[model samples]
Target: MGTVRDILQTKGHAVYSIHPDITVFEALRVLVDKNVGALIVLDNEKVCGIFSERDYARRVIVKGRASKETLIREIMTENPISVTENDSIEDCMVKMTEKHIRHLPVMDHQDRLVGMISIGDVVKYIINEQKYIINNLEGYIKGTR
Candidate 1:
């Protein structure tokens, strides 16, 4: 019954993003500073796409594209799959698996970008839910609940 809100509440929904027109080098600096694998490519504060360190390696460095010369939009994944805050962790997992992605941005009912979630976050929430269920069952068995 747990949702992304639970994970966000614990892990925080604050996101680090970059503008689409910024050079790949600038985006790289933000990624390194945040120690995150990806950055939300924004256009006027709206989620435009997503760029990851992987994209830079595959599209820029390996392909002879200069990081300082290339733009994030040139390499970013456009219109990334997004979810709502009310969505269950299970729903998020299915979407990521079908899409073969590791990250998903969460939004509100009005489609306002809220936070980002990773596969690791989904796994952690599931583990915590299982533990809670087990603990409650044990307590009930011991007549303590």
Candidate 2:
């Protein structure tokens, strides 16, 4: 079973974040530059919320709010669902599914932000693990293991 730690190790622990006070337009620019769907929202170096493309679509575009004037904090999902490095990939998937969220912030033992994982990350890890298992099993059956 793969853990969040495994994913972080493979993906690198680089978390892009934005200040809560930034305008939605600024956040959107960062999202484009990063090529990611979501960002961890930080305030005073602490995780405060998550800002995503979904938030922009539903809150700003749909509501006719000006992206240049609207604050990210007003639309961001505050106190987002998070997981720790020790958590298994399956656990993270369940949480994301139940919460209807695509991204999850990864925290450390002291509640410090370490990295972030998306649903795509979890699915890719699982698929890789399955491929490894299948290869090993095939080798065993063929007397190659």
Candidate 3:
């Protein structure tokens, strides 16, 4: 039953972003440097969209567009779906599954970008939560709780 807040607190709310006007080559370099698959497309400190490797494969490569010549905005997913820090992990999973998305940008109550979470983060958190629950149950059964 952990919330997105718990995950953010554990993982730290650091977001990597790129400008929509940047070339896809530049964005891809940032992605490699950051070791991440997605980057938030920020304009004036606001979430505008998201750019991912999938964007390159689907929008650029498949379409025979040059990465150096193509702007990230041309390939980025515009107005990507986002979640708040208070949103439940279950809610994020449902949205991601339904939308066929891998990453979700997290916002605060003030509508400010806080962090981003991948489906991997959610699954890892859930696995850890289940492990904790199982350990507690075992402790109880062993009269150790």
Q: Count the backbone clashes (under 3 Å) in each candidate.
A: 0, 0, 0
Error of 2 at 136 (Å): 0.5
Ranking by TM-score: 2, 3, 1
How much does each candidate deviate from the true structure in C-alpha RMSD?
1.5, 0.7, 0.8
Off by over 4 Å in 2: none
Highest-scoring model, TM-score: 2
25-114, model 2: which lDDT tens digit per residue? 999999999999999999999999999999999999999999999999999999999999999998998999999999999999899999
Which ten contiguous residues of candidate 2 have the minimum total lDDT? 90-99
**lDDT assessment of candidate 3:** 0.94
Q: How well does each candidate superpose onto the true structure, as a TM-score?
A: 0.91, 0.98, 0.97
What digit string (tens of lDDT, one per residue) describes model 3 on residues 6-46? 99999999989999999999999999999999999999998
Candidate 2 has which clashing residue pairs, if any?
Answer: none
List the global CA lDDT of all models.
Answer: 0.91, 0.96, 0.94
Better of 2 and 3 by lDDT: 2
Candidate 1 vs 3: which has more TM-score: 3
lDDT of 2 at 142: 100
